[model samples]
Target: MIPVAEALERILSALIPAPAETVSLPEGWGRVLARPVLARVTQPPADVSAMDGYALRAADAAAGARLRVIGSAPAGHPFAGAVGLGEAVRIFTGGAVPPGADSILLQEDATAGDGLVTPTEAAQKGRHIRRAGLDFAAGDAVLEAGRRLSARDIGLAAAANHPWLHVHRRPRIGVLATGDEIALPGDPIPPGGIVSSNAHALAALVRASGGEPVVLPIATDDRDAIAAAAEAAARCDLLLTTGGASVGEHDLVQSALAPQGFSLDFWKIAMRPGKPLIWGDLRGTPMLGLPGNPVSALVCAVIFLIPALRRLSGLPAGPVETRTALLGRDMPANDRRQDYVRAELARAADGTLTATPLAVQDSSMLAALARAGALVVRPPHAPAAPAGCSIEIVDLSSLGV
Candidate 1:
């Protein structure tokens, strides 16, 4: 079996980013930008008030000085007249400063009545004034390409006068679960069959990673059935098959798809709970085959499929992020195969994280996987580590898994 990293490399190297499409600014959130968003107009178009205050010349607004009130300028309205010699304009937040105004006297610091205003404090030049282009200038690239747009990005784009944005199309991932002994949830299960959960779980993972999931019908453990189901998903950016990957009498994914132009890149990987993973290509579409066990499939997907989705979605693609944590218990030396131990993560009073492996880590125990907060990573042949040892862990909650 090859190493896990090699298998992931092979899968990502075979894929390309999805094509770009034009979408409205409202639709751009969570989508990867395909082109930079340049500012069409300068922010704060002109000198404007940063707060509600009186706009006037600094020299005329000394402490206790009185000034004539010329007019009022609220947001979206610009003062037409200039403030000359001992004159002030009533201004609110975002109101453009009138011509000849060099400072603002906050209303709280000024008393206004009888068409005149008195300053309780001295006014300083350029104080409380939002200068033109303070936030951004016209023609500036406000957002860069390849960035996943967020709410803040959308607001910035709107301020930059962008009504539409160019973004990569969300990758369409087709998920197929094959097993004669598995039935869909709420469906009639065979005498010894169990309910299927891999497809739905993987679909949620796809959505969380910013891809669209298309769950295909469950294919039974037969060569024709598997081949036909896979053929139908050739149009998808990537096809995922769960079950029928290991070397069992009924494991027919490789043998069945071989006749249908499925090119085998690699079969097993040196990893615990997921040694039977498969990465390959079906005709022109990339294909990833995961183990039948629920926990194994999800763990493998987190390691391999998430990166593939990111690549296809035009985002920086790499391994899922990991952070350091202290081990809460002793761990034995690992073998040649890499290990991802499900564990509970707790924060100490000192703000450090401690990861403790779960007592029962069976691949079929989905409940145990749900209760796990993190996965303590154990590299191949890693020496035994004691409690309080610094270790690397993948935080499941952070990934929305």
Candidate 2:
């Protein structure tokens, strides 16, 4: 058995980023860039107006001096005429700066009558003109390599005239649930039988980590059936198996994996509720064995599956959103292994996020998970935290695949 962080490190080292491919910007969200994105065109393109005003030389705007108005310029339209001395052009927001114009006086600061303009106050040079390439210059590496694409990042790329982006593809995941005691939900349950929920929880975990999950049917305790399912699961980028990871009499995942060339990386994690975690490679595919408990399966998936998905996407780690918040209540004493306590967050009048831990954290309780938005990480052998203690929190919203 090993610590969760150490186990995660070992699991991630097995997989490598394959390569990058060109895809449309619309489909680039959640993917990491393989190479830096260079800007093809300057943003703003040219000097443009920032407001509805008149453009003229600043020195010509003398007190109470009226100037003849030239042609007008609006967004996407250019003024063919130039502004001569003591002359101004009617310009709206986003309009191009007319020729021989050195400043822009807002309409509020100026009076217009009879096709002429008069300034009431002094204006400075380059007041409201958005300079060319103000946001990004052509040929500049606007987006660096290994950067994850978000909705706003896509907009920035589009502003630079990038229609297609080179990004790492999403990882494909295969889920296998093993056990004879667990009955299918729709199947009839005979004495001492329960419905299968571990695989369903793991499938949601895979999607939360930004990977595609394909759930396979239940693999009974029989060695032949487990072996057959493991063999079929090798084609996916990752495979997650629930149950049969312990060394109990009916456990067959280890023995079945040996024949299929799966080098056992680790078989256990030194953590609460999820001790029987198995990680390795089967025919070059990354595979993980999670404990049968629903919460344990979900926790292991967050620790291991998240990182694996990130590595597959060419990122240093799978994209999990994190934030710093204060603990609002005292927590239980932690064991040698780390603990991720589910907590409900509250924003105080002082603008501080206070995380109050949920009282119930059993390995089988899915009801507790449904109401929590963040998890408070407690390190191994850590003492209880009093109220108003700051800690790191992994937010639920950032888990996009």
Candidate 3:
């Protein structure tokens, strides 16, 4: 068996980023930008009022000083004439501060008569004005490449006068779940047949990772059937197979794809619950085979497949984020395999995170996995850990993908 780190490195090195495509800002959310977005127009193109008030020279407003009301400037309607020494322009919010206007008096702080306005508060210069290009200047870089656009990012791009943005194309991932005793949900059980949940779980994972998922039909243990399913899965950019990965007597996925140029980069990783993971290339398309166990498949997908999808989307490949948490229970010494123990997370009175491992860690237990908030990582051959000891954990709450 190979180390988990080596297996992940091999898988990533064999993959490539998806091509770029132009999409409107409305559809750019959650997509990685392919190129830097530059501002095409300056915000507030001109000096505008930040409040509905009278715009006048600051010196003209002394205590109880009255100025002549010359003209009114509502939003989008600017007074063509400038404010003289004793003249004031009635300006509303977002209205252009007429030329030569240097100060403003809020309507609530001033009294307006037939032709004159009286100040009830001191007037300050540049207090209620949004200066030209105040937020951003034209031609300035608004956003950098390789950034996953969020709702706020889309708004910023639109404010920068960008109607459309170039983003990486969503990677198409074909998911195939293979097992002779697996049946689709709602199907009549055939004696010992179990519902196949791996495909649905993997499809959700693909979508969360910003990839388009295409779930293929369930392939039985028969070689011909598996081979036909493999052929159909090859059309996608990446193929994800669940089950028939372990070296069991009935395992046939490896043999089924061998004739189709499936170059196995690695077969097994030194990790508990997911040791049977497979990574390789199938006729030029990258492929990863996860163990059939529901918990194992989801955990492996989180640790490996999500990062691969991020890389394919032109996003940075960073280390899997982890946080330190106190163990709520004792754990025995680990063996040769690195262990990812699912645990429930809680916060202490002092805000410290605590992870309590479930009693049963069977890979097929979906109930226990659902209640897990973190995966405490234990390196191969790690010493026994006692309660209250600090340990590294991959926080499930941190998974935005």
| Number of the top TM-score candidate | 1
Listed per candidate, the RMSD to the true structure in angstroms reads 1.0, 2.7, 1.5
TM-score, cand. 3: 0.96
Q: Model 1: per-residue lDDT, tens digit, 43-79? A: 9799999999899999999999999999999999998
lDDT of 3 by residue, 196-249 (tens): 999998898889889999999999998899889988976688999999899998
Model 1: ten consecutive residues of lowest lDDT: 4-13
Q: Candidate 3, residue 352: CA error in Å?
A: 2.5
Clashes per candidate, residues 3 or more apart or on different chains: 0, 1, 0
Please list the residue runs of candidate 3 whose C-alpha ends up more than 4 Å from where it truly belongs after superposition. none
TM-score, model 2 to reference: 0.90
lDDT tens readout by residue for model 2, 1-401: 68877787787778887467899989988788989899999888889999999999888987677989988998989999888998999999989998899899999998899998989887679899998888889999999988888899899899889999998767778899998888878888757878898887777777766677889989999988998988777678888899998889988888987887888888877777688989888888888888887777876777677878778878787425568999878876788887878778787899988888888888788777767777788878888778888888876545631
Give the lDDT ranking, best first.
Answer: 1, 3, 2
In candidate 2, stretches whose alpha carbon ends up further than 4 angstroms from where it belongs are 184-187, 318-333, 342-347, 351-360, 372-376, 383-401
TM-score of each: 0.98, 0.90, 0.96
Residue pairs with backbone overlap in model 3: none
Pull out the clashing pairs in model 1. Answer: none
Report the Cα lDDT for candidate 1: 0.94
Better of 1 and 2 by TM-score: 1
Evaluate model 1: give its TM-score: 0.98
Clashing pairs in 2: 210-401
